[model samples]
Every structure is written in structure tokens, then in C-alpha cells.
Target chain A: MSELGFLFAGYAVVWVALGGYIIAVGRRQSTLRREIARLEREFRTGE
Target chain B: MTTVSPGSTAQPDATAAVADGGAGGGVTTAAAAPLPEPGRTLWLDILGVVAILSVLVALYGAIIWAPTEAVMGHVQRIFYFHMPSAWVALGPAFTIVFICSIVYLVKKDLRYDRIAGASAELGVLFTTITLLTGPLWAKPIWGAYWTWDPRLTTTLVLWFIYVAYLMLRSSITEGHSRARLSAVFGIVGWIDVPIVFMSIRWWRTIHPTLVTGEGMNLDSSMEAVLMLSLAAITLLYVYLLIVRVRQLDMGSRLDRLRQLSHLR
Candidate 1:
């Protein structure tokens, strides 16, 4: 492939890696928050 | 801007993951505090906005503002993104891991562990970019996609060491043991960074020298774009770190609450 081809490819790899990391973190955060809320409500009523 | 939603924290969906399914299923006094919403951080909004803008400006500077290189033609343009990814990986990312690892070891605080883990993950992400882009630039210029040059080899090793760090964090079920063990490895893993930096100077290698000082020469425009790109990447790293660290903090707290509820 041409040099420009390589250049564009590199940018694509960068964006994909960074974007994926962000999305993964977001997913984990949402799951954790949901658990936290559920546990808190259960504790409130039990008390 | 206010970062919080000012209402009850968390959502209904995450309930399944941390449900005290085994517990008698009742709210306790310890669990009354609301969990902070991870997405609502004001700092994230501010930093995210700034990072996006900087990346846009850096993108323009890298492709349009910087003049093309005479020797390598357009391929050298990849240097703008390429070098900064390596820079962030070797510099702030690992440094944060190293610093936080030490602090975690000394203080035994889970917060530092969270920061170290987050930074290590981000470090690996950027290093993957570096590793990927290096080969792309090399293929057209060096006639091969892979080389066992000193710098490249050390960088690859550096990447693996931190990859192991992440694996350790995820695989260990207990939080304290995970933090303790990973802290040790995190410190050890960071030892390779300086070696990676000095490899080109220490051995006969194909990798370019550091872009500034020490008898190296870079065009004014090239240097400017590189700096801008580095700044943009740094901002992005900070934003990511903020998001990741906050999430980890919340996760750790939830784990504590789980333990507390289990005790009743």
C-alpha cells in the first residue's frame, strides 16, 4: 500500500482503540451504578 | 457546570449484577448512601469538550498545517499521531501507574489502585496504537512490517508487561489481593519505560531519535504539529483517566457495601 494508505490506516487504528476503551468503561460504569442503587434500596427497606 | 444530576444516583438495570441474591434481601443502615452516577461528572464534561476541540485542532495541524517531509514524503506525516501515542504511553500513562502503584503500596488505599489500573489500561491502549502505526510506517519505508530492533523490542515488552498487569487486575477475585499484587507488578512493569526510551540511543536501531534537543533537528512546523498532537493526546488521556478512576471508585464502594450487607 502507499504511504498515505498507511497513514490513514494508522489513524483508523488509533480511533478504534481509543473509542473502544471509552465504550467499555462506560458499559462497566453503568452496570456498577445499577448494582449500587439496587443494594442501597434493599438496605433501606430492611433497616 | 454542575456535573451531578442532583437526584438519586444509579439506575435500575445494574441491580442484577450486585443483587444480594443470597441475602435476606433487605435494606441496611450501611447501604443508605446513594451511589454516585458515573456519567454525570462535570469535570468529564469540561475535559471531554476541551479534549475533543484539541484533537480537532491537532488533526488539522498534523495533516494540513505541517509541511510534507522531503525525504519520506507523506508517510512521515504519520509521525504526528505516531510519536504522541508513544509519548503518552511512556510518559504520563505509565508514570501515573508507577506513582499510584507506589502510593497504593504505602497507603494501602484502593483509590490509588483504581488510578493505576485505569492508567495502565489507557497506557496499553496508546501503546497498541504506537505498535500498530510503527509497522505501517515501516512497511513502505523499511520494506518490512516487523523488526526486532532494540527500541521496538523493548516497547513490545513494555506493552506485554502492562497487559499482564491488566489481566492480573481482572483475574483476581479479591480486591485487596488484586490491588497488592498488581501494585508490585505495576512498579516492576514501569521499569521498562526508560529502557524503551533509551534503546535507540543505546543500540544501533532504525527508530528515530527523540524529536527535540540532543542534536536532533525537526522542522518548525513539524515540531509545532507534534506538540499540538501531544497536547491533544494528553488531554484525552486525562479525560479518560477521570472517567475510569471515578468508575473504579464507585465499583470499589459498591463492593464495600456488598460486604457490609453480607455481614448483617
Candidate 2:
């Protein structure tokens, strides 16, 4: 592979990994929010 | 009402006291409510967009505009972003330590503790990127992806210390005790930062010390691109910090609202 090709490929891989991480963090945030909401509902109903 | 304490005094009549105190004192007391600031959020969003754009432009400049190094060839391109990532990591790590210290010394507020937690989380993210990218770049230049040199070893230790900080946080139940304990750990962990930086400098190492007091000598174009990339990544760190802090704040507010509603 040409030098430029190798460089571009490395950049692409790093960015792809970064994108995946962002998505994972977003998912975790959503799940945490849902869990809290569910707990709130339960506390209210029990009371 | 009865005044039980020695220094305490009771109003002759509660109703009269309220009427007289308010009219005479001109003090309109209300609940301690926080006001919403829309402009700040808008500015943060704008800054986030600008930071993202700057990073993109800087990346283009690094990859395409700057001439490839004769020795390392294309792999040298990674050094621009790599150094910037390391710089960005320092930002959040220092932020975590500084805020944790303030929180511990001042009001001992858990809000700042939470902020420290968020900062530490983001710090880990950036530090991990630095660690990973360094290896990827080094594998081509240094002939080995891993090294036991002072710079690499100290950084690894620094990474583990912060990771331990997070583990310490999780091990404790969430409360004032947890906050205080974590604050102490955070402060202690930060002492390693200077040690890590100094070890590489004080002793000889294979890692190139590019930006020490001796000065960073580079082509004008190379210097410009490096500065731009550093600025872009620093802005990105700020943007990420704001977002993460907001998310934590929202989560806390939702928790409090739920508790209050449960009481009702």
C-alpha cells in the first residue's frame, strides 16, 4: 500500500472506533434514564 | 409559641410579626429556586459545533496539507493528533483533581463530587485514546508497540491510578462518605501527573520530548497545523465535559424530583 493509503486507513479505523464508543455511551445514558424513570414510577405507586 | 433556648425570642403575635417584618424590612422572600439560563446552553451548543468543525479542518490539514516526514513517512501524520490527544487528556485529569479539591475544602458539596466523577470518566476516555494512539503510531516508528521506558511506564501507572479512582467510587455506597473518600483519592492520584511528566524529562528516554523549554522546532507549516489541531482537540474536550456534566445534572435532578413526588 502507498503511504497515503496506510495513513488514511489508520484514520478511518480510529474514527470508526470513536463513533462506536459514542454510540455505546449514548445507549448507556438512555438505559440509566429509563431505569430511574421506572424506579420513580414504582415508588409513587407503592406510596 | 414557646421560646425554649436562652437566646431565642418569640413574636408576641405571629400574624403581626409577619405583616410588620415584611412591610418594614421590604424583604420578599421566595423559595431557593434556580433560574434557567437558555443563552448559556445555546452558546455551549455553538461552541460544540465550532470545535467539531475545527477538528475536521485540522485533521485535513494534518493528513493532506503537511508534508510527510522523510523518516517515518505517512505514519508521522498521526503525531499531530497524538500529541494533541495527550494534551487534551491532561486537561480533564487536572480538572478532576482541581474540582475535587475545591469540593472537599469549600462547602464539601456532593454536587462538585459528581462533577469530579464526570470529569474523571471523560478523562479516562481521552487518556485511553492517547494510550492507544501512541502505540499505533509507535509501532511504525519505534519498532515495538509497547515499551517499558519511563514515559510509557509512568503514563501506564497514571492510567491505572485513575482507573482505581473509578473503582474506588463504585465500591462505596453513594453518599457524603463516598464523596469525601473519593475526593481524597482523586487528589492523591493527581500527584502522579507531574511525576509522569518529570520522569520522562529528568531521565533519558527514547520518547522525543518535543515541547520542553528547549523549544519545539518545526517547519512553519508543521507548527501551524500542530497548534490548530491542539486548539481543536482542547475545544472538543470542553464540549464533551459540558455535555457529560449536563447529563449528570439531569440525572440528579430527576432523582430528586422522584423522591419529592414519592413523599407527596
Residues B48-160 of candidate 2 have per-residue lDDT tens digits of: 89998999999989988987776678877877877777777676555666666667657886678777877787677667776776777666665677766666666677778
Please give the DockQ score of every candidate, comma-separated.
Answer: 0.58, 0.13
TM-score of chain B of 2: 0.76
- Local accuracy of candidate 1 as per-residue lDDT tens digits, B1-264: 224422224444444433655244543544546556645767679889999899999999988888887767787777788889988998899999999999999999888988998999899999999999888877886787877766677778889889999998999966678889999988887876676657645775455632222232469988989899999999999988888888888776776566555445
Check candidate 2 and list the clashing pairs: none
What local distance difference test score does each model get?
Answer: 0.79, 0.67
> Taking the true A–B contacts (Cα pairs closer than 8 Å), what share appears in each candidate?
0.71, 0.16
Q: Provide the clashing-pair count of each candidate structure.
A: 9, 0
Winner by DockQ: 1
Task: Say which candidate scores most in lDDT.
Answer: 1
Considering only the true interface residues, what is the Cα RMSD of candidate 1 after superposition? 4.0
TM-score of chain A of each: 0.81, 0.78
